[model samples]
Target: MILPNSGLMIPWLQSKLDTARYVTAGDLGGEMVADSRKAAVLIPLVLHSSGSTVLFTERAAHLSTHAGQVSFPGGAYEVQDLDLVATALRETHEEVGISPARIKVMGCLAEYFTFSRFRVTPVVGVLQPGFELVPDSNEVADVFELPLDVVLDSRRFERKMVERNGQRGFTYFLEYDGRVVWGATAGMLLMLAKSLE
Candidate 1:
């Protein structure tokens, strides 16, 4: 089921972002002090027979930085790309083998800051049903899907405090099985949830 058009969250999110004032890039938290790079990511939502699910990938364990972590299939923007949306769609096809033609891009959500020193623009897209997936072995360890409703449910969201830079900071965490979903990825999802509301 498509969660009824009533609960389709992207419309509400678009409205909020349209009217809200955005802070300058410098004012954003979690920005890297070193060379800050620009990147784009795709939040691919698939509507399946079981339910609507969000697609995520587990990074290969041997890679440097953020290895063995669950993430959306994406990377830094490339010069050849025309725009952020193209970057996202291209990256998603390269990492997960989902054809760009199969996606209907809804719009873009807020930009997210990563601890790894990259400012990422997350493009929201809906995957057409019956599309095939071919995961790239070099970059992705495994591909998995989680019910969208479960993720949107506020009861499943939790916050934890951690000591960073001699001060305690609270971060949102989403638990599934024994795996932890936190950091920038989770933050983006939380922002999407807020927009949905």
Candidate 2:
């Protein structure tokens, strides 16, 4: 796969994700919960001279849901937010301290619906060099970067059936740093990775 360097990624990815033919996890068939909760996630791509990487956060173990799981910086939409995009941007800043000014919003992926009842929309953004992270301990345990090269590579992710007892469907998983990236979060990444292909 021909990937773009950090400096050139904004427009390239913007056009690609914004215009490409894509499919979300919901499209792959998932048994969603009743009156699904609407949410969004920021797929923040940090640009550097070496290459690009997608930023991910480890949810705080004390959290009631998705604790210790690796995911993008985001959460459920708030009533104050205008849209899912705003939800993503606001949550990104709140969770990781990367201000909206440092990021150039590219586009968004189709929403991924999970058994947990979230209809998550993945918002793509390119983080200009020098963006900093100050994670909120209450919501985030740690922050890490996943190389875009490795993330966009097909070999890194595996497809498996999600056997949620009576609720069954497909999801993708990519292991990194001993933690599992799966379900709705990994599914969003899978959609982005596949869209690039």
Candidate 3:
């Protein structure tokens, strides 16, 4: 059966996002970065006839950090940035060429702490229809879209035990086409999926 609501307004999305229960990567036996470096990422929601899709990027293989790993378009906070939301928008624009003017900031998810040593804030935003993605050679290797339904489904994910330098814990991961979305990225996406429910 086709759903009656075809599109979501910014206000409706904002309400859901505002009340979202934020979850972070569980304790991995580390200090969890008490004075962590602040960063932000944009969960780019794109509208379509069927429903909404999410935009993600693969980091360039040549990059020193997390090279070739799939992640949302985002980066560290700069002094020039007005706020975390602005940082997310600026990085998304820089890495994917999606201008801020074409985006409507709906809401945000809970802050997530990464084992890689950064405190990341996931910002939720809706991308207007028909925005072309221009991936930066130095930052993004590829840009792709995933069905929001796929990401939102709890049944599609599995918990896997992981160890990093002897610190062991379970993490959520979803496999798509040969790529793995795990760690903090998956954790943030989990929050988004739960929020949308």
Task: Say which candidate scores most in lDDT.
Answer: 2
For model 2, the run of ten residues with the poorest summed lDDT = 24-33
Give the C-alpha miss distance for residue 21 in model 3, angstroms: 3.8
**Cα distance off (Å), candidate 1, residue 144:** 0.6
Which residue ranges in model 2 land beyond 4 Å of their true spot?
A: 27-33, 163-166
Write out the backbone clash pairs for model 1. none
TM-score for candidate 2, please give it: 0.91
Q: Give the lDDT of residue 90 in candidate 3.
A: 100
Q: What is the per-residue lDDT of model 3 for residues 25-45, given as tens digits with 9 covering 90 to 100?
A: 433522366667989999998
Per-residue lDDT for 1-197 in model 2, tens only? 78877677777887777678866566247445579899999998888789998888999999987778888998899999999999999999999999988888888888788777788889988886787788999999999887888777768888888765366777778886676788777777778887776
Tell me, by TM-score, which candidate is best.
2
Best first by TM-score, ranked:
2, 3, 1
Error of 3 at 131 (Å): 1.0
lDDT of 1 by residue, 12-106 (tens): 54565566544323113544436668888898888665567889999999988778888888899899999999999999999999999998787
Model 3 residue 26 CA deviation (Å) reads: 5.0
Alpha carbon deviation, residue 17, candidate 2 (Å): 2.0
Error of 1 at 5 (Å): 6.3
Ranking by lDDT: 2, 3, 1
